[model samples]
Target: MTKPIQGFSKLTKEEKIDWIVSNYTHDAESAKIILKRYWNDDEALQNLHDEFIENTITNYYLPLGIAPNFLINGKLYAIPMAIEESSVVAAAGKAAKFWLDRGGFKTTILGTEKIGQVHFMFSGDADKLKSFINSVETKLRSEASDITKNMEKRGGGISKIELRDKTADLDNYYQLHCTFETLDAMGANFINSCLERFAKTFKQEALHFSEFDETEKNIEIVMSILSNYVPNCLVRAEVSCPIDELADNDTDANEFAKKMIQAIEIAKAEPHRAVTHNKGIMNGIDAVILATGNDFRAVEAGAHAYAAKDGKYTSLTDASIENGIFKFWIEIPLAVGTVGGLTSLHPLVKLALEILQKPSAQELMQIVAVAGLAQNFAAVRSLVTTGIQEGHMKMHLLNILNQLGANETEKATLTEHFKKNSATHSAVVEAFENLRKGI
Candidate 1:
């Protein structure tokens, strides 16, 4: 086993990549090979290579910042999140501080079972078809069981099969939900593979269809698809802070809590607001998802779909203040993994998993739940006070300066001038020249 990289944040961009490559089973040459294999465009590949040299692989690195002072489930952790958004890390840190000041974040994960869907299109009677599916449940389970034998040996396998009715269209469509215990893996591939195998067996043994193909029958099988209505496997986190911890003289801490709740309610009421609201939650969760090389797109799709499950858009996080304490909670569909796929192939992702010290998939989900809740806290706190643009623009100025390539001294002068006045690119250039002449 390779020893993990230490003090990653202390290293420069180049040093960080070097540390990741050196510690993992990959080197610069190997990284290049992997990059070329994925990216076919010569110019795009060159750009990546050039950016790698500049230590600007921001996509792979941004969420790596450590969230300190977090004590979840009575265990201390220094969590590293990779995200592009501003204020996420700061917000999580502040929330962690508030919780630690009281006790800490108390969280629980209810097993890891992701739902896979196999859509069946049958012309037969709905009642008879339903009976047929139920009759073959055991056979389907056995088929699923055989596919996940490895996971079964590791204490994870198919747990249940559920059927849902769909009569919105002229054609009758039945959805088969295969629930599987994923153990410490996200199990998208596993679930989909098992569902396909079960579908094959269902047609061969039960449906009596000599020729059944997932594509030909218009039978769509999807894995790890977002179901906000996911059965079980919910991760719940609660953080209680003394009312004084949320103190802001402008608003009573308890009143502040009410306002936070009200703001979330507003997001819950309107689709427009809920989009931004859920985006805030993803701003935190997606970072960790990406860091661990999980499928963020699938996670995002599922979370948003879940938010709208009740036919009304709403915030996924709920906040309350009671008896001189403020509490925050969120339960979102976070299907993430610690091992397999990119976690095994990507060097940086492997390094991130190492930094996380190889947490179980369930434990990882709870941590992500905390992050989503923390992100909501941050967004709400900002919306309630100081407006989002104030801090966002302050951080965005660095990018504007970098685009202009201002040196350290130039950057400081430019930043100062920009703060003093609504500085433009012309103004920045003028400041750059003035500072260069030592005028």
Candidate 2:
């Protein structure tokens, strides 16, 4: 059994590594080597990575790829994607190239209102609490002024503060639901700061208000935090072309459209399919979010919540054929910031945003939405035509080769062999064994 160590974080990096490996693992030296092997050569760069989070370990790596020829609005963009998945970037790029001449993608920002909340409880009169909140609204704003001033100057700040009674949900539950307009930033810190200040002001004002009796004055504030469910903070991306232009691989356009629509409809109605379907969309969304240094966790939460906003989880995408034109689109609540957070700090994040032509928050939202739509299109197109595994497995071939411990010469031979044959794990393994036996 391993004993706990105190102040582990205070130790030097090597000492920390030694403590962990010696205490936890049998092969301490090898484990230590693995951790240190990933460190950057440049000391300054390594220091930058160390400060990103606590408990400095070696930097973890993911491939940063580009999906080129993404024409949105009128200009072209080469979207940077950071992901470990094999086929996502390839599929997105393929979809982008497919739609390159067909007017590319068109996007519209439906709204940009982020949200946060202050949860509290009061065992006193509900009517009195409501009236007290109504009268104290100005005070809430005034108290949070210092936090919101800079944001307001930037044309982004608190949009509204409402008193919501939820006595039925839990004992004396209430909320100060606040809405915000954070123009060019993700606004998590901005929103939360305002909420905390508002919370402090809320309790202070309640205690001093003349109308508030003893019980009402003791308003207990549970917590103040930003919400990730920004249904109103939405963007839409779509692609449309003549129905006759939808043909592929000598397949009829109408039939192809019909099959794609069915696939989407099935996803829209079934949870099992919808989960994977939406995951495919996130494969694109998360990659861009990672590359641009936005919070993928918050985006994922908001998006999934929005998908089920209508009472049941469904597809985030839609497809249709109308007026001899085939159309596909996706509307997602994407709360991303082009400034602040990791966007300016991380070197790769800055490069990724620059490569994207330095879009505003709204433009970034549109670009992300387009990438998701394009990815889903590629997935559906493959699903309804050639099947998903055909392309996915091909992209996954290298991973399998690496896993099987194949040398460069053997991997090359196997790669060529799999191009003409199936790439299933068992099949590849069997083929490798047979090839070794001169078969």
lDDT of 1 by residue, 1-439 (tens): 7776566666765576565666664467686455345442566544644454344433432537777777888887777788776667877787677677667878887646677777776654566656666777888777666677899899888887887776576466667776777877778778778877777776666435324334333343332232433536678877777777777547677667778878978887888998998898888788888778787887788787778778887888877777767777887777777878777766677777777768888888888888788777777887887677655555567776787777787788778777865454565567667777788
Candidate 2 lDDT, 178-225, residue by residue in tens: 999999999999999999999999999999988888878998999999
In candidate 2, which residue pairs get closer than 3 Å at backbone N, Cα or C atoms, i.e. clash? none
lDDT of each: 0.71, 0.92
Query: Which portions of model 2 miss their true places by more than 4 Å?
Result: none
In candidate 1 the C-alpha lDDT for residue 243 amounts to 72
Candidate 2 clash total? 0
Model 1 scores a TM of: 0.76
